[model samples]
Each structure stands twice: as structure tokens, then as C-alpha cells.
Target: MDTTIRQQAELATAEIAEVAAIPLREPGTELVALEAAPAPVAEAIRKRMDELDMTNTQSIISFGSAAQAELQQISQAMLADVKNKDVGPAGDSLRGIVSTIRGFSVSELDVRRKRSWWEKLTGKAAPFSNFLAKFENVQSQIDKVTDDLLKHEHVLLKDIKSLDMLYEKTLDFYEELGLYISAGEAKLAELDATTIPAKEAAVAALPEDDKMIGSQELRDMRAARDDLERRVHDLKLTRQVTMQSLPSIRLVQENDKSLVTKINSTLVNTVPLWETQLAQAVTIQRSREAAEAVRDANDLTNELLTANAKNLREANAVVRTEMERGVFDIEAVRQANEDLVATINESLQIADEGKARRAEAEKELEHMEKELRETLASAKARDASSDAGASVPTA
Candidate 1:
């Protein structure tokens, strides 16, 4: 969607086009024919064929891409390498063929060429026949090497392609997995933002779950909350009662003590002190129960938060693990691509360079060969001239 990506896409398209135009021909057959030729004429025909041969670079590139994929898997394997790096090997092989092409140039062909004047000068002489033998041997050596290089490349390319396909599927898996992780993270953030406070609020409302606890406990908590509310109301009434009673007690204090003197009873009134004690105890228990109600609310809220946190943490762990796997995979794919390109380029360059050097050497060899033939002819002429004068004596 962005400019950089768009540019890359365009470049890929152009590359595909360029590679498409490059033909991938197997040059070994021609080389073999040249080797199998018994004499100069047959070999010359084969040479012409090779000279005219074309290559399909695009197909080679396609095959090279496959090899790249295989290398990726092999490089990233955590397990016993059940899979191999087919692409790297295959590409190397194919590129080697490309190298072979450059290595055996037209000069090499010329180096092996029949001297154009051989038919006229030597006909089928043993020396001429001997030259042909040596030529054929060299030709066979070149063909054998070429065949091997091409054959190896073909096998490797197929394997690399298979690996490449698997690599693609692996990458797709990571992409989908990453999306799930991203979504999960977003959900985690939302949960964290809302769950803590929401759980607290839900518990405070004396919700149905709390209302169901032990049935008896639920009733007690409700009773406690209600009593607190009611006591506040009751305290209003108690205020009036205590106010009136307080005035009376004060009045009693103002009156004579002998008439109001209290009597202690062991049998019927000994427990009279228990009334004051029991009233005080009941008041204290109500206050404790009220405080317990608020504590229950907080504890329930905390329990829910702790449970939710556990689930969230588990979910996050899964996402983190998955993301790490994806990251590893993504890096592997990127590196594979880089290696693939380098391999192809290096192969092409090697082929081109080898071809150039071989061509140059072949040309120089051709020139030397021509000079040797010419000098030999001149030497023969001199020998004939000298022999002419001494012919009688030699006989």
C-alpha cells in the first residue's frame, strides 16, 4: 500500500519478465555429439548446433527460487533435518551449467576446429588422423563435464522447488498466526482496562452469587446490612427513649437515695447484671457484622480479578510464543530470498567470466596453431629444396 512496497512489487514484475526471456537449454547433448563424432566434418556440424543454441534464463530463475525456499527450511530446522536445503544446491548446480556455458566458449570450439586446409594438404594421412584423435578426446572430456553439470542442476532444481512450496505454506501459517496474536493483545488490553473495577462494582451490589453463598451466610450478610440501615433508623427512636430515660435518671439522682435503693437477689435477680452485659454484647456483635459485610464485598472482588488475571496471562503467553515463532519464520524467509538472489547472480557472473576467458585463450591457441602450420609448411619447402641438390648422392 505504501510507496516502497509498490516499488518493490513493480521491480518483481520486471524481474519476472527479464528472467522469462532467458531460455534454459541443455547444452550437453550438443557437447556429447561433438565428442561422439569420429572426424572433423561431424564435429564441425555439432559445433554449429551449439553455437546456435539459446538459453531460457527465466525458467532457470524460477527453478532457482525453489532452491532458495529449500535452503530456508534447512537453515531454520530445530528438528533433526528431516528436510534438506534443496534450493541452494539445486540453484548452485543450475548456475553451474550457466557457468559451463561461459567456460566453454566459441574459442574452445575453434581450438578444436579442423584446419581448413587439412583436406587438401593431408587428405587422410596418419598424422592428420592422429590430430583428430586428440581433438575428439578433449571434446569428450568437455562434454562429460558439461553433461554432469547440467544433470546435477536438473536434479537439484526439482528438489529445491518442492522445498520452496513448503516454505511458502509455512510463511502463510505465520502470517495468520500473527493476526490472531495481535487481536488477542488488543482484547487483553481491553480486559485489563475494565475487569478490575467492574468486578469490584459487581460484588458490591450484593449480586445473586453472593446472595447464594451457604444460604445461611447469605441470609446473615443481608441481615447485617439491613440491621445497619435499620439501626440508623432505630437510633432515632432510641434517642427519644434514652433522652426521656436520661431526664428520669437525673431526676432520680436529685431525689432521696433511701427510697430508690436497689436490692440484690441471688435466686430471682442475681442474673440482673447479665441484662446490661448481654445488651452491650449484642451491640458490639452488630457493629462487627456490619464491618464483615464490607470485607466480604472486597474479598469477592479480589477473587474474580485474580482468576481473570490468570486467564489473561495464559492467553498472553500463547500469543507471545506464537509471535516469536512467526518472527523466526519471517526472518528465515527474508534471508532465504537474499541468498537466492546472490546465488543466481554469482552463478551468472561466473559463467560469463569463464566464457570470456576461455574464449580469449581459445583465440590465442588458434593463432598459435595457424603459425605452427605455416612454419611447418615452410620448413617442408626448404627440405625439398635442399634434397633436390643432393638427390643423386642420397639415392
Candidate 2:
């Protein structure tokens, strides 16, 4: 890692941490009460109870009814925005961007080379340009998305503030409902245990004519108490709704905060790291290409030198041998001279044999002529003797 780049990264991380840090409330100092009420809750209940006289049951009933309406409004207002929101799509988009970044490869940016000698020596710096163009394109997408995320962050921050206000108001309504319910229960208990019983006794003691009026008054008081009980029940139900809203508001706010922090981290840290790593990858790739070219050149040079040396050795050997030799070798001349002498001897022997055969044929012809002349003479003598005998006698 470069010193400057490392420092910049450290600085970016620090900035992200500082910017994203949130101030937290101390443990057990929560404002919303779920189970147990504190001193303030007790005081609020007592004060609400003091506002209504037990004899005026109508007033107590009115108080609970009003509280019920108010709590319902608070709960509805707090949950209005919560019901329509979903954070899933935003998370999906972020994940897709992260996947795209993860899928990036330095190999994709490499220029394909034919690796011929000329191409190696005069190769353009296309790899660097290719890497730069691709990096810029990726960075551009990230920048556009980050810009959108920043806008979303601002909107989410505003929403957190809005939810905070709604949460506080909901808590107030919860406590108010508690006050209404507690006071209504106390008034109901008093009427059931003491007031109603006493009224019944007073009516029973009245004379026949006055009993009807006292009984009617007792019935109205009982009706008022029942109405108050129903109102208190409604108030408690609204309070339950408010109770549920508190956590929902908090959950939405926390989700927005988490997304904001993630956006900040991407802007400050992850993007810069990508740039740094990509540059390093390109640099390393170029160095490798250069080293390969040098190695190939050395190997080619070695092969050419080896081939030339072998050709030179063969040419030199042939030329030197030709330069040292006679035009006609003595061995070839001696073999041809011996072949000519053998041909002369064979011709003389053939001529002598032909002359001896001619002389023998001439002697044989002279002897054959002499034998023919003697045979002719003997035949002539026989013919002459036969002729003489024929002329002399027939015996």
C-alpha cells in the first residue's frame, strides 16, 4: 500500500465513524412506560381524580370519554406513516450494487494481443487506456447511485426527526389514558362499595310516596357509574394502541439510521478502496506484460542465434571441404585406366580366335573336293563296264 493512500483511507474511516456515531441514552432511563408507572404517573392519576367529584358521576364519565377520543387520535396519527412504508427495495438495490462491484475483474480490462514480434516491440498502451475507461464507467455508476443514496439519506434523517416527535406525543397520550383509567376505576369502586349501598338504604327508609323519586335517583347514579366503566375500557384500548406505536416508530427510525450509516460508509471507504485496488491491479498487469515481452524477446534471440550458428557451421564445413579438394580425384582416374586395359586385352584374344577358325575351315574344304573327284571316277568306270556287258551278250 502507498503511504498516501493508506493515510487517506484511515482518514476516510475516521470521518465515517465520527459522522455516523449517535448519542445514546443511559440504561434504564427510558421515557415510555410499559409496565410500571413512576411518581409522575401517580401524581397525574391523583390530579385527574381530583377534577371530578364522586357525587357528579356524569362529570367523571365525561372525563373518561374525552380521554378515550384524544388517545385514539394520537395512536392513529403516530401509525399513519408506518403502515405504508417498506425498506426492502432500498436494501435490494444496495445489495445489487455491491454484487456488481464484487463481480468486477481486472482481467476484463486487458487488451487481447496477437504477440507477434512487431506487436510486442511496438505495442500500444491499450491496456492502460482500457483499464481507465472501464474503471471510470464503474466509478460513474457508483457515483450516480451514491448521489441518489445521499438524497435518500437526507429524507430518512428528516423522517427520523418526525418519528421522534410522534413518539414523544404518543407517550404523553399513553400516560393521559392511564390517568383517565385509574381515576375512573377509583370512582367506580367508591360507588359500588359505599355510595350505591347507602343510596339503596336511604330509598328503603323513605315512605311509600317518596320511595319512587329516591329509587329513580339511585337508578341514574348506577347508570352513570356503568357509563364511566365503559368509557374507561375504551380509553385503555386506545392506550394499548399507543403502546404498540412507540416500538413501531422506534423500529422505523432505527432502520433509516442504519441505511444512512451504510451509505456513509460506502461513500467514504468502499469506493476509494475500489479505485486504489483497481489502479494497483492495472499497474501489476502492465509490469507482467512488460516482463513477458522481454522474456519472449530473449527466447527468440537465443533461438535465432542457435539456428544461425548451426547454419554457419554447416556452410563453413562444406565450403572448406570443396576448397581443399582436387577437381578430379586420382582414385577415380586409376580405376578408369584399369578398365580400358582390360577392354584392349579382350579385343586381341577375340581377333586371334576368329583367324584360327578361318584357317581350319579352308583345309577341310580342300580335302572334301579331293574325295568327291575319286567317287565320280569310280561311278564312271561302273557305267562303262555295264554298257560293254549289255552290248556283248544277253546272258
Candidate 3:
């Protein structure tokens, strides 16, 4: 009989132990660790929790309620921040800068290549020099503005990324809390369905048989019943706590989801749309400025061409007048003939002097020859008279 009671008590103790272990056997779920969140976000949550008196509270219900309220406030603030931030003016400024750059680029390319005829002739760069100076100034301004815009964009994107991370962390916290609450509720339900019924059956069966009524057996049975009852009470308390926290957890989850949706809309839709529109506006402004510059260049070119045409026409008219009035006549030809006449007169004078000298010399020569012939004749006559006398005597 003792053996049978001992077996029955062992079975009861085993059943009670099993029932008591149900809640403890649940997997642990927890909120997102504060350390995992960004420092600024973590600090903000800490400040909010402090304001709600959550840090010192031992009541899970109170803490959950306070946290939910804080989370809601944070969500609202984030949404307001996003909604109220203004980037339109910055975008307009960027557009203006880009337009100026485009205008300068177009003007530089056009005017530099299309120098006026006067500009080319005089080798003066006044027109293009002024334009280049203005172009450099505008380019510098564009560089500064673009640098500033990039810096601002970087900061804004960083802030947005941080906010997105905070939202995700908040979502994780609420989801984890919800899972914990759910698991707690399931443990309670399981205890009610299985543990409580087994204990009741064991208690009811205790008085059914006299053989089960020994003093030690009854004490053991009573102790087991009391322990089972205590376990049920503890589980009930846990269930109540979890039930009380459920509303707050669900509230936070809903609020977090809403905030996430808003943030995602801004990141994917609103911000992108704004950027696209700004780009289109800048493109349009640039195109308009370029077109205007082109028109101005065309007008300047036409003016230059017209002035060149006028100058060419005046030069052609002068050439025609010079040709028609014999301004190109050969005065040198007449001068050359006058010089030839003077040379011919000098040559004739020289020839006449030579002829006169030659004639005089010829006459002198004839006189000398005649004088020699006369002398010879005299000597011959003398010789002949002498010879005749000698011959008359000697013959």
C-alpha cells in the first residue's frame, strides 16, 4: 500500500513540476538594445523615458504605457520635422547658378571662336576679354554654390539615414515587446488548459479511495496541490501583467508603422520628386539662357559682318576711282625717254669733236708729205743738171 501511494505521489509531483515549468520554458524576447541604436537616438529615447517616469518604475504596465506615449511623441515630432523642412529655395538657387554657368559656357564657345573682322585686324581682345572675365566669375560662383549644395546634401542625407535607422529600431522594439506579450499570454492559456485541469483531477481523485488516504500520502498530496495552486496564481499574475501591457505595445507598433510609412514616402517619393523637378527646372533655365546667348552672338556677328562689308565697299570704291582717273599712269616712262635724249645729244657732240680732230691731223700729214716731195724734186733737179754737165763732158 505504501508503495502504491509512493508511486502516486511521485506521479503527482512530476505532473506539478511539468505544469510549473511551462512559463519558464518560454523563449526570451526583449526590446531592441539601446546600445545598438544611434547615440543621438538613444539619448533622445532616454530623455523621453525620463520625462515619462519610466526609469524608476517597477510596474511593467506603467513602463510600457510611458514608453508608448514617448514613442508616439517621437514619431509625431519626426513627421513634423520632415514636413516643415524647406529645400525649395536652395533648389532655386542651384538652378540659377547652373543657368549662369550654361550661359557663360555658351557665350565663351561662341564669342571666342567668332571674332569680328575689326577685332582680328586690330589684334584687340577687348570684346572676348570682357566676356572671359565674366565667364570666370560665373564659373567661380558656380563652383562655390555647387560645393555648398553638396555639403548641405551630405548633411541632409546623413540626418535622413539616422532617422530611418531610428524608425527601424523603434519598430524592432515594439515587435519584440509584442512577441514577449504574446508568448506570455500563450503560456497562461496553456497553463489553464493543461496544468490546471491536471491538478484539479489529482485533487479530486485524492479523496476518492481510502487506500489513497494515508497521513504521509495525504500531506504529500496536499503539498502538491498547494504548490500547483501557487504556480497557477503566479501564472495568473503574469498573464494579467502581459494583458495590461498589450494595448500599449500594440499602440507603439501602430505608431511606429505609421512613422515608417511617412519616412519611406519622403525618402522614396517626395525627395526624389523634388530633385527631379529641380533638375528639369535647371535644365530648362540652362537651355533658355543658352538660346539667348546664341541669339546675342548671332547679332554681334551680323553687326561685325555689316561693318566689314561697309569697309570693303569703301575700299573698292576708292580703287575704282583711282583706276578711272588714271592715278596709276606711267610717269617714269616719259622721264626715261627724256634721259635717253640727253644721252644721245652728248654722244653726238663727242663724235663731232673726234671728226674735227681727225680731219686736222689728215691735213697736217699731207702738208708734210708734199714738203718732203718738193725737197726731193729740188735735189733731183740739181743732181740731173750736174749729171748732164758731167755726161756731156765724159761721153
Candidate 4:
């Protein structure tokens, strides 16, 4: 039993020493430091925490408590066994010391347990309230960013849609312009095909007389030739104007085509890609917020546990000092224990408030998530409809 007690004490002492060596700041202090410090300093702190292999501070406290309890139990049993063996003065003195220490350890353990229960009841809000606030703030900022991006996307889509309609109208106009130009060419061809040839034949059939004959046939023939020449000259001038206008129309059509291509590219590729990336950014930010919340909660839990351990150690020291002075204070111990229980109960009430707050936060998050999902679905449907419309054969 003595050997077992010695081993257990040694193990407990080592555990305690290990925990003490870790430079754990008070709850929320690290978060504050992180917020206030420069980027490089914050990053360095993060790196240091990672190197220590201390992902969860609560685990350290739990291990320390378990080791301490094991040590206390072994020591108690050793003291009892020594009393039964009829040990001498030296052994009696050792047993007395062990009994006092065991008593103090038991009281300390009870207080620690009460404190732990209180902390658990309060949840993360007690020690890490600022972290919760920060999480909410980040979420709000992300929501704003998403809203702004969606608004811009909506405007872009609307403009692109309008551009697409204009492109189709421009194409139809180009076709109509081509038909108008073609009609002018056809009119010119008709003159060459029938009227010009017939007129030339008539002029050739006329007698090559130098004298102005008073015959009606000569006058009618000359007049008809003159009328045909005027018609041909007017047709050529009209065709020249129409032909000149073609290049300007074609230039406009080329510009329309380029504009259409650009709008289509933005709609099909750039806008969608941007929306996707924005969604991913929101997701990443939410994930980061969640992770920070968890880490902060763990830090708070560890802080509470450490405080409990310190109190326990102090209680043990007081008991040991009183024993050396040949004094005991049973009433004071009882009062302290009662006060601790009352404090724990009050903390439990606070915990209820925290739970309520947490529930409200969860509901808000759910609503936001639903909104985001619907928005994404709407965007996808719009994209799909646009694609289907684009693939259809135009009349």
C-alpha cells in the first residue's frame, strides 16, 4: 500500500507539474490578444499552440483531476493500512499527515466538482462571451457580402438579358438591310435584262438621218430614248446610295456582334464563376466562425477547470498548515462547502440563459442557410433556362 501510494503521488505530482508548465492565459485573454495584436504576432501564437499539441484545454484539466483523485485514494488507503499494522511514532506521524492531506484533497475535490458542474451548466457564454459576439459579427458581415454580390449579379444578369434581346433585333435589322440592298441590285439587273436592250434596238432601227424630220415617228422614238436614259441614270444613282450605306450598316452589325459575344461570355462564364466563388467564400467564413467558437469554448472550460484545481491546491495547503499548528476548523469547512454549492446553483440559472441564447442563434443560422440555398437554386435555374433558350433554333 505504501509503495502504491508513493507511486500514485509521484504520478499526480508529475501531472500537476506538467499542467502548471503550460502557459494558459485567462479565458478570453487569448482572444483579446489575437484581436489586438498584429497579424504576424497572432500567427505566431497560433503556431506555438499547435506546436504544444494542445488542441483542447479542457482535456488537460480532466487529466489533472483524474490523476489527483487516484493519488488521494491511494494515500488514504496507505494511511489506513499503516494504522492497522501498529506502526511506531515515525509511522504514526506519517499516517497523521496523510490523513490530513486526504481530508483536504476530498474537500477540494468536492469543491472542484461543484465548480465544474456550474461551468457546464453555464456553457460557453460565461467565459467566452466575446467569442460568441465575434462569431455573430462575422456571420453578419458574411451575410452582407453575400447580399451585395447577389444584388450586383442580378443587375448584371438583367443588363446581359437586355443586351441579348438587342443583339437579336440587330441581327434581324441586318437581314432586312441585306434584302433592301439586294432589291436595288435586282432593279438594276431588270433594266439591263429588258428595258436597256429593247431601247438600244429601237435606236439602232432608226434611220441615220442628219436632217430633223417633222415625222411623229422620229420625234416619238427620240423622246422614248431620252426617257429611258433618264430612268437608267436615276436607277444608277439610287443603287450607288444604297451600296454606300451597306458598309455603314455592316459596321453597325459587326459592333453588335462583338457586344453580344462579350455579354454572352460574361453571363455564361464570368458571372457564374464569380457567384460560385462568392458562395465558397461564405462557406469558408462560416466554417471558420464555427471552429473559432469551438476553440473558444474549450479554452473557457479549461480556464474554469484550472481555477478549480488552484482552489483545491490552496485548500490542501491551508489544511496542512493548520495541522502543524494543532488546529482544525470543521465549521469553517462546512460553511465554505455550502457557499460553493450555492454558487454552483446560481451558475446553473445563468446556464439556462445561455441555452436560450444559443437556441435563438441556431434558429437564425438555419434561416440564413435556407435563404442561401434558395438563392443558389434560383441562380442555377436561371442559368439552365438561359442555356436552353440559347440552344433553340431562331426563326
Candidate 5:
């Protein structure tokens, strides 16, 4: 990784290390209360045991009962708090914010690119302004989510402190258990070493007939010590619970503290940085769009001016040429006169050919008429001759 990132990681590790250095009461350390006492300690311990209520099991177990009950409550509270306070949703929201940031882009912002002519002239684009409004709304949402996370952090910190107190309470219970066990052991040792032996010797000195009755006190003392031993065993069991609970409390507190640290970092470092970068990106994008719009406007203006100039040049050339011309040009009049003379000459030639064709057609018609009349007269004469011949020779 980068050196800066490495340094940051080291710093974070150091902070956690410092926290871990805080002393915790090690399991079974309370056993030291039962360590070997000095030679003179037996007499003192015996006197102390004499003051205790050896026969009352209820009184003996009271402190242990209280310790166990409180430990149980603490454990339950820790479990319930762990179950009820979920950081998952907050973490998911943070991840969602990251995804949103990654997905967001200036180009995704709605911008009316094709504006009216008046809008173009006014140089007013609503895209950036609208983006600002939307960004403010999104910022509000981010703030709300962050605020909830901050509240969760506060609750976790408070719970962690409560767990610290619980840890101390567990240690106190452990020490109480050790004291009860040690005191009970000392009493047991004294009963075995001194009290029971003395009682048995006294019973031995009694007459054989009364020995059984005389040993009753001894038996009673033994029974009381047995009850004391049982109570101490109960206390030891309670201590075992406390031993286990210490680490559980610490682990829960550690988890809560770690979540608090993460939330602090997100709120103080990551979020502001992300927002700042986003704002800068938006500003840069708007600047780019503005620059592009100006360039496009300038290009469009240049194109229109060039086209208008060309059209104006062509229009002026046509109009000026038309203005310089006469109403009727001499070349046009001369071409018309030549065309009229050729037309009249072609008409006279066409009329003469028509008259000659008509006169030939009349001569042809007269010749046909004469031929027809001559053929008819010949036929009529042949018919008369045939008739006269047929009548004279009536054969």
C-alpha cells in the first residue's frame, strides 16, 4: 500500500493497542487468597471462624447468591443490548452512500440542452441551478442518515461504559467468592486439625457407656463444617461464572467501541471529504458545459454570418446586373426582325406550291371524266348490236 495509508493504519493499530493495554483481571487470579499462610496464621484464622455463623447455610450463601444474581442480570443485559442494537442497517446505509457517490455523475444531471432562441440569447441554462436544488435535498438525506449513525455511536459508547462498570462488578464478585472459599477452607482445616481431634479425645476419655452420648457435639460440629464446605463450593461456582462473564463483557464492549470508532471516522473524515469532492466535481463539470456552450454559440454565429454574407453577395450581383440593362436590347430587336422576314418568305413559298398542286389535281380529274364517258358510249353500242342480231336470227 501507499506510505500514507500504511502510516494511517499504523496509527489506528497504535490506538487500539493502547486501549488493549488497560489491565484486566485474569481468571483464577483470585486463588491467591487461599495461598499458604504463616505458622501463626492458624490461630488467627480459627478465631475468625469462631465469629462466623458456621451452622447457618442461608447466611453463608447470601453474598454468593447476590453476586450470582447480579452477574446473571449483567449478562442478560449485555445479551439483550447486543441483540437489540443492530449496526448492520447503519453500515448498509454507509455503503449505499458510497454506491450513490460512485454512480453519480455530472452528465446524469438533467440539463435542457436544446433551448429556445430567447433562452439562447439570454444565456440562461437551468441545469446547474436545478442540480443545486437536487443536491441540497440529497445532502439533507445524507445528513439525516449520518445523524442516526451518530446517535447509534453515542448509544454504543454509553453501553461500553456500562460494560466497564459491569466488568468491575464481576471482579468484585470474584474476590468475594475467593474470600468465602478461603475462609471456609481455613475453618475446615481448623476443624480437622484441632476441633474434631480434641472432641474425639474428650469422647475417648468418657466412660464406654456414655461415649456415644458424649460424641454428639463432635458429630454436630462435623456436620456444620460440611455445610460450610458446601456453601463455599457454591461460592466457587458463582466465581466461575464471574470469570467467564469478564471476557464476555469485555468482548461486547470492544465491539461497541470499534463500531463507535468507525462511525466517528465516517462522520468526521469520509463524509465531508466525499461531499467536498462531489461539489468540486459538479463545479468543474458546469464550467466545462459552459465553455462548450460558448464555443458552440460562437461557431453557430460564425456559420450564419458566413452564409448570410454569401447569399447577400449573390443577391446584390443579380439585382445590380438587372438594373444596368436597357428596357429592350438592340440585339433582341435585330434577331426578331430577322425571324419575321424569314417567316413571311416561307409562307409565300408554301402558298405557291399549294396552287400548283391544286391545278394538277384539276387536270387529272378532267382526264378521268373523259375516259369514263368514252367507255360508257362503247358499251351501249355493243349492247344494241347484240340485241339486233338476237332478234333477226330467233334461234
Candidate 6:
């Protein structure tokens, strides 16, 4: 790139780099809380579970209890048949019981594991009934929460975009306002363009009045009108202001750039210091749908947020419970993922090699995103230096 283009590129790079350097502590309170969520994904899962509860999900899993009892009975019958060496129809009956026993085993285990999943797929399989029984409402609750969260986020994004669009529209409006000033200026400029002889022409067009008496009143009125028009014209002519120039395009891309900078600085840079503390404040778990809805139910103005908050708390509790029960370290894993991504990005500023590596990654991302990327390439190619020299104004 030539000097000006290079400067633009450098500016872009510095902005991105600054973003990369941003500390995690600077995120908005909402995003920070979400990042620190005990089980963030659990929020989505909880919504689905809630919907399950609304349908009287408990009634749908009645087969789970019966299935378990039947399995135990079948096992008892099979044992008796085997001991007595029973044969014929009675033996056949026991064999059938064995088959049913096998079916019920999975059902029993599923209910014990995750009732929501099992019940949602209820009746499709004899097994997993128990797992389905466990959640009683997992999918429904998860769906509800997921929908609500996505909806809330979408609305916020739309609001920001609407404001952004209005900002652009306002620029356009101001542009038109500027032209009014220009129109006035043009009228004034006309006075400079024309000579006083042009005014005398109109006066000459009138009948000779030298011999007439009391013609001064008519002359005075004519002069007064001419003077008023001339002065107004002069004022407009001096108003040489042009249309308002468009702002730099970079300003268009930003949504509260200052806020972005501040948040990035706090969130990314100070992550190590605050991550542990954040982890302590939150919990994480996957729980049943019914349980989540109950936990999420809130009396707040936004039923959605209130519900989400409740779901968040329940999800945190469940995830925490699961973490303890299964001895799984959720925080450690989350931290590792977050830290690794951050480190890779920060390394770009350290070395030229890193920049090239990141460039390769960027290309890779582009390729992955597009199976066919030839749309813009159809434009005719030109000599790079010649084009750069051309006065198209630097982008």
C-alpha cells in the first residue's frame, strides 16, 4: 500500500489490536454477568424445560413408573421359570418377559439419567422413560429460556441499529439544511455578478419623468423595493457555505466507540485478576425443565428477564450440584478456553510471524464461510500503481 492507504490500514490494525488488548473487566454489567454465568448454556436449556412444565409434563411420564416395576417383576418371573425348567407356552411366556425386561432396562436408566430428554421422546422407546421422567420438563424449559434470551438480545440489537440508522438519517437531514444556506448565498452572489446598469435598464424602460411633477414618491418606492431585493441578494451571495461534508466512514462503523474501548480494556486485560472472583459469584449446572421454570419465575417488569434471572439461578445451582457430584471442574475448563483464545489474539502484536499466521487464519475463516467467493473479483483488474496515482480519493 502507498503512504495514505498504509496509514488507513495502520489505523484499522491499531483499532483491532486495541480491541484484542482489552481487558475482560470492562464488559457491560449485563455481559459481564452473563460471562460469569454459572452455566450460560444452561439458560437456553432451562427455557425448553419451562415449556415442558406448562403442558402438565408430569402426567406424560406415568409410564416410567410402570415400566420400572414391570422390569423387576419380569426378572423375578424369568428366574422362577429357569429354576423350574418350565417349557411350552409358560416357558414362551417367560421368554417374552425376558424380551420386555431388556426393553425396560434402558427406559429405567434413561429416567434416572435425564427425565426431560427421555420424556420428550416418550412412548417412542420403552427405555429412557426414567430419564425422561427425571426432567419432567427439560426441553420445554430450555426452549423458553433460549427463546427469551435470544429475543431480548435481538431487541437490544435492533434498538441500537435503529439509533444508528437515525444517526445517518440525521446526517442527511443536516445536509439538506446546509443547501438552504447555499440557496441564500447564491441569491447574494447574483448581486455581485450583475452591475448597477442592469438595474438602470428597468428604470430606463419606464416613461421619461424629468418634466413630470411629484414623481419622487414613485421613484422612492421603486428604489426602496430595489434596495431591499439587492440587500437580500447580497446576504445570500456572501453565504458561501457548501453542503455539509460527510463524516469519516469509520464513525459509521462504531457503536459507542468510547464504551467499546473502556469495556475491552477492563474485560480482556484484567481477566486473570477477576476471573476467579467471578467464578466464585456464579454457579453452573444443567437441570430439569420444571425445576428451571420454578426457579426462573419472577415478578419483575420484564417477565422475560425475571424468568431468565430465575432460570439463571437454578441453572447455576444445578450445574454447581452436578460439578460437585461428578467432580467435573467447569470453571477450569471455561477459563482455559477463554484464556487460550485471548492469548492467541494478543500474540499477533508480538511478532511479524504472528501477523502472517493470523492472516492465514483470516483467509481460512473466509474460505470456511464461503464455498464460492468470486462476486467482487469479476471487476476488471488494473495496474496497481497507476490506479493508486489516479485521483479517486483514498478510501
Best model per TM-score: 2
Clash number for model 4? 0
Give the Cα error of residue 148 in candidate 4, in Å.
Answer: 24
TM-score of 3: 0.27
Ranking by lDDT: 5, 2, 3, 4, 1, 6
lDDT of each: 0.43, 0.69, 0.51, 0.45, 0.70, 0.39
How well is each residue in 1-395 modelled by candidate 6, as lDDT tens digits?
A: 12332243234435544433432211111111222335743353233223221123232222112212433453355345443221233223323423432333222432235445755666444333333443334323323333332233233233334333443443433332233323323323443455334545555566777423324544543454454444334423322221112232223324334333333333233322333432332222223434555655643347877789999999999998877664547888899999999998778657878788999999999996674455434433445556768867766
Instruction: Write candidate 4's Cα lDDT for 1-395 as tens digits.
Output: 12332243334333333322433111110122433546765554344323221223342222212212443453355446432222133234334433432332212212113346766777634323433354345444433433333333333333333333333333333333333323323333444677556656665666767233424444554454444344435434443554454454344434433433433333344434544554464466557668878989999999999999999999999998877763547788889999999999999999999999999999999999999999999999999988888888878
Candidate 6 structure, TM-score to reference: 0.21
| Backbone clash numbers for all candidates listed | 10, 0, 0, 0, 0, 66
Better of 1 and 6 by lDDT: 1
Alpha-carbon lDDT of model 1: 0.43
lDDT of 6 at 278: 26
Task: Name the lDDT value of residue 224 in candidate 2.
Answer: 77
The best candidate in terms of lDDT: 5
Q: 1-395 in candidate 3: lDDT tens per residue? A: 12332243334333333322332112224333444546765555454333322122233233334334555665677666664234454455456655764665434434336677987798866554555566557646644554444433433443344344444445544543443333333334444677556655665666656545544454554454444444435534543554444454344434433333333333334434544553454466557668989999999999999999999999999999877875445787788889999999999999999999999999999999999999999999998898777656542
1-395 in candidate 2: lDDT tens per residue? 23343354345444444433643221221333322556877667667767776457667557755544554564476468554345665576577668757767666555564345765598745655756776777766666665555555555555666555566666666666767777667767778999899999999999999999999999988887787788778777767776787787677767877776776566567767876787788788778879889989999999999999999999999999999889888999999999999989999999999999999989999899999999999999999999987787554
lDDT of candidate 3 at residue 4, scale 0 to 100: 38
Q: Any runs in candidate 3 off by more than 4 Å, and if so which? A: 1-67, 73-97, 107-130, 180-395
True-vs-predicted CA distance for residue 66, candidate 6, Å: 77
Tell how far residue 303 is off in model 4, in angstroms: 12
Candidate 5 stretches greater than 4 Å from native: 1-30, 33-52, 66-107, 110-134, 201-224, 295-395
lDDT of 3 at 391: 56
Candidate 2: residue 249 lDDT (0-100) = 69
Clashing residue pairs in candidate 5 (N, C-alpha, C atoms within 3 angstroms): none
